[model samples]
Target: MSGTIQFKQDLPPKGGYEPIRYKRNLPARGPGGLAVFGGILAICAYGFYKVGQGNLEQRELKRERAWSRIHLIPLLMAESDRDIYRREQAQLAREKELMKDVPGWEAGKSVYNNKRYNPQNFVVM
Candidate 1:
């Protein structure tokens, strides 16, 4: 036993605790390396490129459909209007023939409104 008890704090050895050994000490056993990292990066890049291409293609298809609707809608509306006018004309001719004996029944006369051309809509639906 010492006459006076002494307390000594533990200290690192020389060379500052062997440079701390901060790097991983596990064995290089996994299937990973620079080559694997590079391959994974390349695969991710390709996947992103394919996704971008698909998005672009989808956008183009949507644009085409939109343009087609823009061009066709008016033509379809005109054709439908023409068909309605033709049917009305046919009905007027039948009425003129059937009501030949009756008078004051004017054919192709506006009964509801005085406007010759009714207002049309431009909705996409």
Candidate 2:
């Protein structure tokens, strides 16, 4: 009977259990120290990775710009040549018309004869 005896409580504290004494700011238990070290290492690695990526991106942009400049040189030369050819054609046409009106040349023809077409005066783009 004594071994089987039990105690029962009819009321409980209003605010639950409390400790009369405890240690303050004890060194954290578990793997907290390892977790903090790992976290710092991960942050540093990420920062370095981002820096490397930025450098690579900058180099790629510079390479692309160089390629664009190289490609544009040929295009500019071709455009200037085309403009010159068109101007030459216009000059030849004017000469042919002048030869046809040699006997009956008008004042308008004389006025236009002094004005010549210049390739450099035109904009390609």
Candidate 3:
């Protein structure tokens, strides 16, 4: 009822103004963006390296196969030559047996007689 402000007996105590104490808990920043980019680059580089290694292996395998074929070619040729020589030897043996009992039909004479007799039988126009 007086000119000055008055409070009731049960009013709360008045204290000096105090700023709010805000505890800023920083968030956990995950792996850096640059680190992720670097990891991707490393993976790509490793993939390329593996591809190059595979190509090299393929080339080496091709070379080995080519060399094996090259080595086999000479063996094949030698076998063919041996077969031809055997055939010639068998032919000569057969010719010897055929003319063995023939009189005056020796190895050289038989070949010469065949050539000369065939020409004589052919009439010239």
Candidate 4:
């Protein structure tokens, strides 16, 4: 189809024709947006890795504490028992020393220094 239509009136000549300098209307985008997004993603990934690492460390520490408790309980009980035995032995030695000064002390009744009045023998006023 090569049919062309001719205008009867002459058209005015176009004056001061300014061509478009740029093709796209959008502003120039540098690597700033991509760099910022990449930086945020990297930070998030690092935080996630740290959280996982901390959980593993916490679990390891708990396991070690449990193991220490399991192994030290028997030793601690034995040490407590030894301390009690030593205290009893010391008390027995002191009692023996005190008894050495008196002859036939066990044969006599045990005496207590009673300073207070006997409440059991209270008389009705």
Top candidate, metric TM-score? 4
Off by over 4 Å in 2: 1-22, 25-34, 88-125
Candidate 3 regions off by >4 Å?
A: 1-26, 80-125
User: How would you encode candidate 2's per-residue C-alpha lDDT over 8-69 as one tens digit per residue?
Assistant: 87775888768666667676677787898999999999999999999999999999999999
> Which sections of candidate 1 miss by over 4 Å?
1-32, 88-125
Candidate 3, position 95, lDDT: 65
- How many residue pairs collide in each prediction? 0, 0, 0, 0
* Candidates ranked, most accurate by TM-score first: 4, 1, 3, 2
| Tens-digit lDDT track of model 4 for 10-113 | 66558755775777678767778889899999999999999999999999999999999999999998998898667655665666666777876652123446
Error of 1 at 53 (Å): 2.6
lDDT of 3: 0.73
Q: What global local distance difference test value does model 2 have?
A: 0.73
Clashes of 3: 0
Q: What TM-score fits each model?
A: 0.43, 0.39, 0.42, 0.44
